[model samples]
Target: MERLQKVIAQAGVASRRKAEELITQGRVSVNGEVVTELGTKVTPRKDKVEVDGVPIDREEPVYFMLYKPTGVISSVKDDKGRKVVTDFIDSEQRLFPVGRLDYDTSGLLLLTNDGEFANQLMHPKYKVGKMYIAKVKGIPTRESLRQLERGIMLEDGKTAPARVKFVSGNKSQGTSIIEITIHEGKNRQVRRMFEAIGHPVLKLKREMYGFLNLKGLNSGEARELRPHEVKQLREIVEKNKCN
Candidate 1:
């Protein structure tokens, strides 16, 4: 048995906080009766939960790593009807993406039905790193690279420090591939980071998330994260919380 919000979030309908708002807004029901209290506990196997009259799915905990393809938005569904991350998924576990990749960006994206697991990974305090290889408009200068590595100012604020590697460029600065790793989860951060330095990203592909990377998978393909990989993820979360 678990709290109502946890069940709703694990069902992939919304995050735990949003689920609480649904409860407070008097939108959730249990066993055909309205349940607005946050303390409501449910035996998922026996209880029925409805959000706006639609039954929430109770599925086994599942995790997946997908090599997101270009032009696919990383989301459960797009109101505009554009192709989304789930369009690459072949499972029926009611999973949702842990984070997002822009419609034009590509590479490593995770989807899962485990809400707490998603929370641990997305939380900035966990310091989960995201690594990307970006093809930018031009190679950045030494000072610009230094600024990026230290932390650059964006309108949202100064970005967290980043780890970057690449050549300053020869004659192919316009086609330079810059490798960057950061622990921040700001919106379109990598693209914005490069743009701030006058070398706007022409293409961006995430290659790693924390210790997980897209090695065997290709664009648009996905695979279940091995048990050991999941264990590592849990460890990362636990270890960080302890500190």
Candidate 2:
């Protein structure tokens, strides 16, 4: 027997933290009885689960890295029938994105049914850095660079200090290439950062997240993570478990 959230995660409903949310919201049922407490546990072989009225059960976990493309939403389903990240990967098991990539942006994204793994990576306390290559309008002045590096003021709050560099650019093209690395995962943050400084992003691609990168992968391609990579990720989570 395991904690209800753990069992729900093992079933690939969502991350463990998300599973807790579902439980508290009364979306989870075990053996026809609603369970709203995190301390609830069950024997998978004897108990049944229903999340949002759909039967759920434990299955072999799956993990993959997808090079998400523009026009594809980072969701399990879209009400408007738009293309989603799952459409790029063919798998029988249910998987959810660890984090999100905006519809207009493209690059490395992690998909998995392991809720604990997703929670560890996505939790802000870990301070995982995400790097992006952005093409934007005009060259950012030294003042603007300082603003970004020092922590730009956003509606939510001041952003954390970030790393920024000018990759290449010229006024003739009316665009410039710059790379920025940030720890915060605000919605459309890279684009909003540039737009905040009067330079709007023309294109954006995530280059790296923590140790994950897009190497030898084309747009819309999905590949399972290697055993060593999974081990390394678990180590990261365990190392920071106390913090």
Off by over 4 Å in 1: 31-33, 37-47
On residues 17-55, what C-alpha lDDT tens digit does candidate 1 reach at each position?
779999999999999999989999999888999999999
TM-score of each: 0.89, 0.91
RMSD for all candidates, in order, please: 2.1, 1.9
Residue 193 CA error for candidate 2 (Å)?
Answer: 1.3
- For residues 92-148, could you state the per-residue lDDT of candidate 2 as single tens digits? 888889889999999999999887778778876677778999999998887897899
Model 2 bad stretches (over 4 Å): none
Clashing pairs for model 1 are: none
Query: Which lDDT value does model 2 have at 198?
Result: 95
